[model samples]
Target chain A: MAVLTLAQALNQGLEQALAEHPEVVILGEDVGRTGGVFRITDGLQRRFGPERVVDTPVAESGIVGMAFGMAVGGMRPVVEIQFMGFSYPAFDQIVNHVARIRNRSRHRFTAPMVIRMPYGGGIGAAEHHSESTETIYVHTPGLKVVVPSRPADAKGLLASAVEDPDPVIFLEPIRLYRAVRETVPEDPHTVPIGEASIEREGTDVTLVSYGAMMKETRQAAEVLAERGVSAEVVDLRTLVPLDTDRLLASVEKTGRVVVVHEAPRTLGFGAEVAALVAERALYSLQAPPKRVTGWDTVVPLKKSEQYYLPSVGRIVAAAEETLTA
Target chain B: MLQLLTPSGDVLGEPPLSVDLTRRLYRAMVYVRTFDRKCAALQKQGRLATYAPFEGQEAAQVGSAAPLDPEDWMVASYRDAAAMWMQGYPWELLIAWRTGDERGGRPPEHVSVLPPSITVGGHMLHAVGLAWSARHFGEERIAITYFGDGATSEGDFHEAMNLAAVYGLGVVFFCQNNQYAISMPRTAQTRSETIAEKAIAYGMPGVQVDGNDLFAVFTATAEAIDRARAGDGPTLIEAVTYRLGPHTTSDDPSRYREESEVEQWRRRDPLERVRIFLSERDAWTPEWQERLETEASTEIERAVELAEGMDGLGPARIFEAMFDELPPHLVDQRAEALRSVGQ
Candidate 1:
């Protein structure tokens, strides 16, 4: 095991996947020489050669559509679309072809591909770069949406995504790329998709979140513990194949729930979690479920970006509301 | 224009394949034409859903697809059923798809054809990707994509061509410029002299052929396919043709086009010219014509029966096919879909 950042873990993970699976090829803009803008794919082109790690033209739809065909043509392609906001150009391809191929061909011709993008705000990045639109993919049928919170999970979940039979939207938390450093296994390992991890153990209330929000959720849990109130933090790694069992168990035990995300409030991922809690665990709930999310507005420019993202104070305040209720 | 046969059934250049292969091509074109007419008739009779007839463009579809190896890939659009069938998509499944059955989209194992792309230009990139995969893996196979002239207006068409040429991907962009995309005439689609000329912008060779002549379309497609297999890079072929029938079952040709124009195309019918070409060479006969029609009738009837006779798409079917394995949420939704129908 070696201590690594989330970005390093992902780079090593992709390197490992390339070394093992000859069919696995990386396609995206600047993925070759530049190693991607954020350096998430850094040093991959040199190690794996330009053939395997392709540097594609700057067309989102072209990158994804070509990747989809490559997947159908019997190669496992992983595409990077730079940022979440830029993914809109290829949204039609993802929704129509990449997601529909498996169903359209009746499992005969499947697009076993992965579309990776660094998402969420608070990086003070330029326009269209800091947008948390993971919910759009979550709402799309046939597309498996996943998010990683830590280094080990990022590496392992990526491994699982590469080998999956269906298309997976691997949403990397941009803010957490170098936010935390931890020791990850050197040998190959996979954190299976579709399962949630309980980051902290408690009983008073459950903090439900995924991706970048996990950091703030964990901080809220610490604050609650120091205040003598126990709080459990639930990190939902896979949003599509959601770990409902773990989510319900945590809610049923605590009986008070607070869902947090950087995306907007209306129909955000938190809405689904909140609705599920109300539907299946209504009776088990001692307090009504609360959602701490960004406002229903365009994620503003980098200026005043702090006002837009879900802050640690906002998460703690929402958790306190659930506790008081 | 690159052509091997004139509009009057006169051989102009060397035949792309042997006479025996030419006979087979004629038989397949006749069969697909019969099937196409039957689908339109069925749609009129309310037996099938809306039908996109490929009557006038038979040579363009069949001829281009005839040269592909079975292992090669084909990404076609809704109006290219003849091309899709030639590439191994079964008649029954194509018919089933027209009848609105998802099961019809599934081709048998070993058929490398994708379900016909309904979107205008979206599927062209799929051909680019298939070609990329083939080249990346050091495979000799190539991908041929079929799209209409109207599909050329879509941004994806540009991207596909540019990327394919840039990467030296083995692919054939076969555009059947059949004079119109629904009510919009081909002249309104683009200002370029011809769809084939657009390939020049992408740094690839482009060839326009008489789409009505089976030998002409076949020869052009064969040359492009050869170039692709030899790793000479992608090529775009524009088959100039006109559709005799309306775009689909719901269309009215008289409202937008001239009847005299349609009559002119009738004289240049792809099937009749081939029949003339074969008959003058003593390969066609009255007895053979009767047998071809009878066999076509039988084949189409059987496919129609198979398509109409399938079991109803129950709740399980609706839920299935989305993913290899159902996630927890889908499992619950499937149960709910079943319960809603009281199953």
Candidate 2:
């Protein structure tokens, strides 16, 4: 086993998927020769050749629309959206066509494609570079949304996304690209979509989150431990088709919950999580579930983004609200 | 033979019809005419949902659909039941949809026709996609997609045209320009002089034909299909027809279009033109004319009974056909819905 960063894990995962499935092809801006803007596709072009690792023009709609055709043409396309913000241009194809194809055709046709987008805030980038718009994809019916918090999970989940019969929106946390190092096994296996992982076991309060927010959630859990609060940390791997059973089971064990995410507080994925807890495990809860999230505003540029993104302190405070109640 | 008769309902120059082909074409056209009328009446009586009548457009649909090889795929919009029927979609399926059943017109597997697209320009893109697939898979089958003048306003139309042109895929873009979109006249639809010329922008040949003339519609479409099969890329055919009825039975043409415009188009009515062509040529005798009406009415009655007798579907059907292979979660969701409803 060798230690690899999340970006490196993604590259290895794609390489494996292409080698495994003859139908799988990688296409995106800079993905061919330059190995993607973040270098997540580094060395893939040389390894797979330009035909399989295609570098596309900067037209987001064309890229997505063509991929839709290619998917219908029996190619398992893994299309990369250069950045999360740049993906808005292709949102129409993604939401209207890719997400709804199965339901619209009533299953006459299925889109076995993966749309990869680097998401979430940090790296001191300018506006639109860092935003968690996972909720938008999650809200769309007939789409499977998956995000990985660690290097191994990223590799495993991506392989599964590529193989999934339905189209999958694969969100990669940009902040965590080069942040962590872990051994991503070769001949990597798949992780089931919509399942949550329990990062740390505890009973005092459930500190729930996913993607970039998981970093802060882990930090907050550590701080809570020092303050004599045993926080149970649950990392949601996929937003859509959420592993509600795991979430409810955890919330039931702790009897209290604090959900966090970098996306805006209003109508965020966290709100869905909170609602699920209220509906399934309401009587088991000792106090109301608290939500720690970003302000309901556009993701500001580097200057005030720190203030905009949720922090460990904010999560800890939210968890403490359940404690006090 | 491209067409054995002319639009005035006459046996045309050079080609003498054996009794069989003439009888078939006449019967098909009559059935479509009656079907269009019945749809209008059903909509008026509230027995059927909204309808897109092909009353004056019978020749356009019948002529174009006649020559299609059975294996060739068809992609159509809200109208075009005549073309769809000629391509072998059961007439009962169309009736089911008009009568408010959702499963109506859901394609039978292996029939090669996609369900009718309700959104104006939606299925045009799928047509391009399916054509691309056929070309990639080395399948010789051609895809013929139908849309209207109003569909040109949608972005998907432009995208589809550009894609089909660049790919040189086996696709026929058939635009039935029926003079108006609801109440909005063609003048208000586009700045281009003719819808056919729009094909020039995509670098494809475009042909404008009198949609009321079956011979012209068939000959032009057959030539386009031949070109597409030979790998010459797509052709845009603008069938310049007129809708003789309200946009739907629910619409009142007097509100937006003048009665004079309607009267002028009625004078050029496609059915009458074909009847005249056949009568003047001595092909439509009083005896053959009686048989055509009787045969078409009997066929319509059989389809109506079959559609009315089909089994009723439940909500589970909504979730059932959504995938070729059902995903585990959706299977659970379907089961949950069934249990909740106490089924």
Candidate 3:
């Protein structure tokens, strides 16, 4: 086991996939010669001899549509969208074709491809670089959406996403690229796509979140613990095919819940989690499910990004409100 | 021999583009025309749900499709039944799609063709992508993708054309400018004088041919395909044609167009033009022509029976194929569906 950052974990995962599956290929802008904008694909083109690691012609829809065909042709394609904002052009291919191909074909074909994009605000980036739009993917059926906050989870989750025989939208928190470090287990087994993990166990209140929000949620849990309020933290590894059983069981045991995410509040994944708790574990809840999410407005420019992201203070306030309610 | 052979029927040409191929071309067009008419009637009788008839556009489809190698790929829009049929896609598959069976319409990977795209211009991008791969991996196979005048209005059409042109891919953007996109006239569809001219923007060769003229369509398409096979890059061929029938089972053309205009197009009907050309060339004979019509009718009748005899598809098949390997939640959903259906 070797300690690695989120960037290194993702790179190790891509390397492992290349070694394991002959059909596995990588495509993205700057993914070849420059090792990707983040260097996740660094040393890959040289290792795989460029055929398996492709640098596309800066066409988002073209990359996705062709990857869809390649997957149908019995190849496993792991495509990287340079940024979350740049991925919108390929949204039609993702939702209308890639996600619906199997359902529309009545079991004749499937798109077992992975679309990797760095998401969420923070790091003072320009417009379109820091949007947390995971809810949109989670709303779409026939797509598996996964978000990883830690380096170890990034390795395990990405490996699982690449190997899964279904279309997956893997959203990595860009701000956490070098923020967290942990031992990246070589030859680590893939984590199941729809399972959530209990990062910390406590009985007072549950902090439920995924992606970048997991960082704030964990920090808030620590802050609450200093005041003797033991917080239970649940990291939702997969967003679309959510681990409802794990979340409901955790909230039922804690008797309180606070859902957190960086997407806007109106119809984010947090709302879905809140609705699920109200429906499935309402009696066990001592209070209504609370939500800590971005405001219902366009994400402000980099100068105001700190205000846009759900902060540790916000998660703490939401958890305390859940306890009081 | 089939009637309506090309004027060049007597002229000796290359092995694949010879006078003998004229009779085969005419037979295919006539068969597709008859099939289109039968489908219209089926829609009226409610035996088929809806259909986009390709009555006067047989030459454009048959001419372009005739040159494709079995291993070469094709992607088509909704109004491409003639091309799909000529390419040996089973008639039963089209019937299944018309009858609204999800399982019935996907292009067989073995056949190297895609199912008809219902969206206006969506499949063109796929065609460009596949062709790009062929060139990238050193495969010489070409891809032909069909679209309509309405599809030209889509952003996807321009995007696909630009990408194919830049990559020098082996893709033929075949556009059948069939007068009207439902009710909107071609004049209203684009400000440009011709759809082929749009190709010039992408730095690719553009050629315009009479879609009703089998000679012109055959010659132009064969030439474009030759250019593609020789690695000369993408070509845009605009087949100027007209749709003589209603847009679908639901449309009434009288609401949008003049009857006199329809009458004029009817006079220049693709089928009639070929028939006259073949007769003048001495390729027409009464006895053989009658046998061809009888054979086509008998084949369509058998196809209708075969399509109707297939097992009915249920709604649950929709969720089954969404993934190659079912995830855990989907497995649960499959079980739930089974319980609901008492399976």
Candidate 4:
């Protein structure tokens, strides 16, 4: 297992998927000879040929809409929308057709397709390039939403998404693309779609998060350990088919919880995690669940983005709120 | 626009359709018109859900769909039931969907027809994709998408057209310009003189046909399908027709259209010219027409019975189709649904 960045892991995963399944094709703008805007699909077109790794026109809806038809027509399509912000143009196809095909046709047609978009607000990119709008996809029924915080998980989860019978929204954290590197295993293995990964084991309080915010969460857990506070860190790899059992067990063990995400405060994914803890582990809770997330406003330009994204200090403060209570 | 048989049954051009083929098309038109009228009546009686009657566009739907192989893909809109049926979809399942059941959205596995797209214009890409997939697999199978004059205003329409041409994908963009999109007329939909002319910008051939003339639609679609099969890329066919009935049973034509205009189209009914042509050959008679209507009625009644007979869909069945296997949350929700239903 050679060390690889998150972007390299994703490229290897797609290359392996294309080699393994003749029916699989990758289509997106600049995905061909130019690699990708992020180079996540770098060298794929040259390695696999243009047919399997395609470069499409600058139409998000067309890219997704055509891929939906390809999927319905029996090809497994992996589409890359440049950024999470650009995904709105294809939301109609994603919501109406891709997500509803299997249920609307009653299993006669299934969209065995994956839509990957880089998301998060750490990078000082152009407008609409660094937003975590995964809540919208997670809210849509009949879709599997998976986000990976590490190189190994990105490769494994992507492999599973390509093979899944239904459509999957695989959100890659743009911030973590080059920030972390690790030895990713070879392809043909899968990190199950519905399970969560426990990043750190502790007992005093639990820090639950996913995607880019996991970095800060792990930092906060380390700081809490130095300050004589044992904080458990739970990385929710799969948001839709949430590992509710593992989450509740952790909540019950710590008897306190603090959820974190890069998305806005109201109606964010953190709200759902908090609600789940309240519903099942309320009796075991020593304090009410709290959240350390972005403000209920637009993800600002890079200059002030640090104020928007939850920091380790903010996460530690929230965890201490539960501890003090 | 190309016209083989005029409104008054006078031939302007001799189409390549054989007499036997003409008779077969004539019979199919009669059946579709009968089905269309029956559905409108059923909707009035609250038997079927609000139906989009294709009373005036029969020739456009039936003829354009005639050349498609059963194995080819059909992606049509709500008003193109006739086209869907022509592509070998069962009348029962098509009607079942109108009964507000998801099961009706399902067609037989071998029938390569998607559920009729309710929203406008988005399905055009689906056709392009199906044809693209066919070409990628080294197969000659082409896909046809049916939309209306109103759908031309959509962004997806332009995108689908450009993509199909760029890839030289095997697809037919069949637009039935039926005069009105709800209350708005076709003239207000676009400034272009003809919808077919839009294909020029995309470097594809465009044909405008007398949609009421079945022979003309058949000839145009056959040529387009042939061009697609030959890997010559997509073609756009604008079938200039009229919607004699309201957009759906819920709509009222009197609100936006005049009776005189409707009367003017009534004289050019798609079925009448076919009857006139058949009568000249002594192959059609008053007796034959009566027998055909009787047969169509019986056939429709059988389909209605089957569609109405479907039952026993329990609450759990609602969750069955969302995923291959229900996720943990859906499983919990399914149980909750069953409990709410007192099961």
Candidate 5:
């Protein structure tokens, strides 16, 4: 085992994938010489050679569309779209082609590829730099959406995403890229695509979140524990093909739930989680499900970003509301 | 600008192809023309859905495809049935696709052709990627993508071109400039004069060919394929032709184009030129034409029957292809679908 940051773990995961599968390749803007704008792919091009780790022209649609064809042509391409905001240019390819190829061809052709983008907001950045748009991918059928909270999960989930037979949209939290370190396993590992991991087990209320927001939710859980309100923290690793079984079990145990996300509250992934709990575990719930989320407006710039994003206090208050009810 | 055969049954110079090869090309054009007419008739009879006819563009499709290795990848739009068929996509599957069956989209594993892309311009990049994959795997295979004049106007066309040129990927951008994109004329589509010239901005060699002449298309595509196989990157071949028919079965050409223009193109028909060339060489006889038509008609009839004979696919089959294994939500949705159908 080795202590590694989320970025390092992701690099290691990509390295392992490249080594294990001859068909696996990595392509993105600045992924070659610059080692990616975030340096997550640092030295990957030198290690894997230019053929496997390619630096494509600045065309998001071509990057994704070409990867889709490569996948069909028997290559497992892991593509990176510099940031979440830049992924929109490739949205048509993702929604229209990547998500539909398998269903359209009736299993004759499949796009076994992964599109990774650094998402969410925390570090001061310009407009269009920080955005939480996982809900759009989650809503599209025939795609698996994955998010990882820790370094170890990032590696394992990325490996799984690369090996999956269907297209996967792997969203990396921009803020969490270098935020934390953990002893990640050196050997190859896979975190299944549709499973949820319970970060902390409590009986009073469930604080559900994933990706960057997990840090705030974890903090909220600690504060609630200090206040004598035991809270369970469920990090939903995959949004699409949601682990409803795990979610319902957690809700049934706690009998109260507060879903949290950095995306806007209206029609966000939080709404899906809240609705799932209401539909399946409503009778077991001691109180109505609550949501702690970013406001239903564009994520603000650096100065007012804190006001727009869900904070630790917001999560704690939501959990407290569930506990009181 | 290259021409081996003129529109009036005369050779421009020494024929680039042998008499036997010219006769074969003529026959293939006749066969595809029969298939195109049959599809149009079927669509009119309500037996098939919207059909994109490639009647005037047969030479561009067949000639470009003739030089391709069977293993080469082909990504084409809705109208290039002739090209796809030449690349080993079965005619039955093509008909089945037009009949709205998903099974039609599933080409045989040996065939490297993708399903016809309904959306314009997006699939060109896919061809680039496939060729890139081939290069990565140390395979000598090349990829070719087919689209029309209107497709060049899409932003994806520029992206695909730049990527292919930058990476030196083995691909051929086969754009059949068939004059109109639905109701929009070629003149209205772009002011660049010719689509081939667009390759200049991307730093790739481009060629303009007489699309109605079979020998020119065959020679140009052959050269392009050789360059790609030699790792010379990609070439953009713009086959300038006219759409003799409507954009599709649902479209009426009279709305935007003059009948006089259509009449002029008819005089330069892709098939008639080849037929004239074959006749001048005494390779086209009445008996031979009769036998070829009978064979092509029978083959098409069988394919249509096969396409129409399959049992309707159910909701279970519809749900099966979405993923290797169904998730809980899809399982629930599939159950609901089954219940609704009284299955």
Candidate 6:
């Protein structure tokens, strides 16, 4: 095992996947020679050869649509969108074609592919660079949406996403790319696609979050512990096939819940988590479930991004409300 | 423009096809025409859902598909059922699809045709991908995608064209310029004089053919397929044709087009020109024509029977096909769906 950043872990996972499967191909804009804008695909083309690591034209829809076709043609393609902001052009292909091919063909054909995109805020970048829109993908059926918060989970979850039999939207937290490092297994491993990971176990309240927000959530758990309140921190690695059992179990044990996310508050994934708790484990609640989320507005530029993101302070306040109630 | 046979069945030059091949082409067109008419009738009888009739574009579909190797891939739009069938997609499957069953989309493995894409222009990129994969695997196989005049207006068409040209992928962009995109006329679709010319912008060879002339379409498609297999890259062929019937069973062509124009196109019907050419060459007989029609009718009848006999797919299939192995959330949802249906 070696300590690696999330980007390095993802690169290793891709390299491993390419080495293991001849049918697995990587295609996207600048994913080859330039090693991708984020360099997540660095040195992949050199190692795997140009055939396996393809650099496509700057066409998001074409990248996805062609990948869909390749998947249908019996190739396991991993397509990369440079950023979450640039993925809109391919949304039609993703929603209309990629998501429905299996159902449209009645199981006779399946698109076993992965679309990787770097998501979430905190980096001082251009207008479209910082955005967390996992909710859109989670809302679409026939797609498995996965977001990993740590280096180890990034590596394991990416491996699992690549091997999944259906199309998967692999959302990588842009902020966590180099911020955190962990000992990742040298041998390829998979964190199951539909299960949640318990980062810290506690009894006072459950703090549910995924992707980049897990960082602040973990910090909030530490702050709550200082106040003599044990806070359970849950990292939902996969958003679409949510680990409702684990979520319910945590909420049941604590009898209080606070969901956190960086996306808008109106219809964010947090609302779904809150609803699930309300529907199945309402009697176990010590107080009404609370959510700490970004406001319903476009993710602002760097200077104002702090106000837009769910802060550790906000998570602590939400946790306090759930505890005191 | 390429033309081996004129509109009035007159030989414009030396015929490139032998008498036997000409007869086969005529027979294929006749079969497709018969199938198209039968599908229209079925829709009227409520046996099938809305049907897109390729009545006048038979030669365009058959001629283009005739040149493809049986193992080659075909990605066609809703109006290209004739092309799909010509590429080995079963008539029964086509009928079943029009009956709105998902099972109909599942063609046998040996048939390389994808289910007809209902959306405009999206399948073109799929053809490019299939061809690119074939080339990557060092296979000689090529893919041909069929769309209409209206589809060229879609952004996907441009993207597919650019990618096919840039990658030098083994694919043929077969556009049957049938003068209309549903209610929109070709004039409204693009300002360009011809769809074939658009390929020039992508740095590929482009040609317009007499879509009504079997010999011209077959010859052009054959050459394009040969060039693709030779690793020379993609070719775009625009078969200038017309739609003789309404776009679909639900459409009313009278609302958007004039009958005089329809009457004018009817005179240049794809099948009639071939029929006249065959008769003039003494290659066709009245008895043979009658026998061909009877055989086509009988085959279509058997297919309809087979399609109608199969039971509707169970609701479980809805959840089953979405993923290779259904996840827990879907498992719960499936159970809820089953309970709601009193299953």
lDDT per residue for candidate 6 within A1-325, as digits (tens), equals 9999999999999999999989999999999998999999999999998889999999999989888888888899999999999999899889988998888888777889999999989998899998898899999998999999999999999899888889999999999999999999999999989999989999999999999989999999999999999999999999978899999999999999999999998889989998999999999999999989999999989888888998899999999998778
TM-score of chain A of each: 0.99, 0.98, 0.98, 0.99, 0.99, 0.99
**What is the per-residue lDDT of model 3 for residues B1-343, given as tens digits with 9 covering 90 to 100?**
1122333333223323444677788888878877888888888889887988888788889988988887777888777888887777777787777776665666565676777778777668777767755765677778889999989998778778877887677888999989999999999999999999998999999988877767777777777788888888889999888898888878999999999998877776776656655666677777768888888888887877777776666645656676666666678888788888898
For model 3, report DockQ. Answer: 0.47
- Compute DockQ for each candidate against the true complex: 0.86, 0.34, 0.47, 0.88, 0.83, 0.78
Q: Give candidate 2 regions above 4 Å deviation.
A: A25-75, A84-97, A123-131, B1-26, B278-282, B321-342
Give the poorly placed runs of model 4, Cα more than 4 Å off.
none
**Considering only chain B, what TM-score does candidate 3 achieve?**
0.92
A1-325: candidate 2 lDDT, tens digit per residue: 7799989899999999989987778878889899999998889889889868878756566567667756765678899998889888777777877776666555665678899999988788877888788888888777889989899999999998998888899999999899888887877778888789999999999998988788999999999999999999999998877888889999999999999988898899878988888877999999998989888999888887889888899999989889999
| Alpha-carbon interface RMSD for all candidates, in angstroms | 0.7, 3.3, 2.6, 0.6, 0.8, 1.0
Off by over 4 Å in 3: A18-22, A46-52, B1-19, B107-109, B135-140, B331-343
Q: In model 1, where do residues sit more than 4 Å from their true spots? A: B13-17
Against the hidden true structure, what lDDT does model 1 obtain? 0.91
Native contact fraction, candidates in order: 0.88, 0.19, 0.36, 0.81, 0.78, 0.70
Provide the clashing-pair count of each candidate structure: 0, 15, 2, 0, 0, 0
For TM-score, candidate 1 versus 3, the one ahead is 1
Instruction: In candidate 3, list every pair of residues with a backbone clash.
Output: B4-B274, B4-B278
TM-score of each: 0.98, 0.89, 0.92, 0.99, 0.98, 0.98
Q: Share of real contacts kept by model 5?
A: 0.78
lDDT of 5 by residue, B164-262 (tens): 999899999999999999999889999998899999999999999999999999999999999999999999999989889999998988888899999
Q: What does candidate 5's lDDT look like per residue over A1-325, in tens digits?
A: 9999999999999999999999999999999899998998899889989988999888999999999989998899999999999999999899989998988888888999999999999888999998998999998999999999999999999999999999999999999999989999999999999999999999999999999999999999999999999999999999988999998999999999999999988899989998888788889999999999888898999999989889999999988887777
List the candidate numbers ranked by DockQ, top first: 4, 1, 5, 6, 3, 2
Better of 2 and 3 by TM-score: 3
lDDT of 5: 0.92
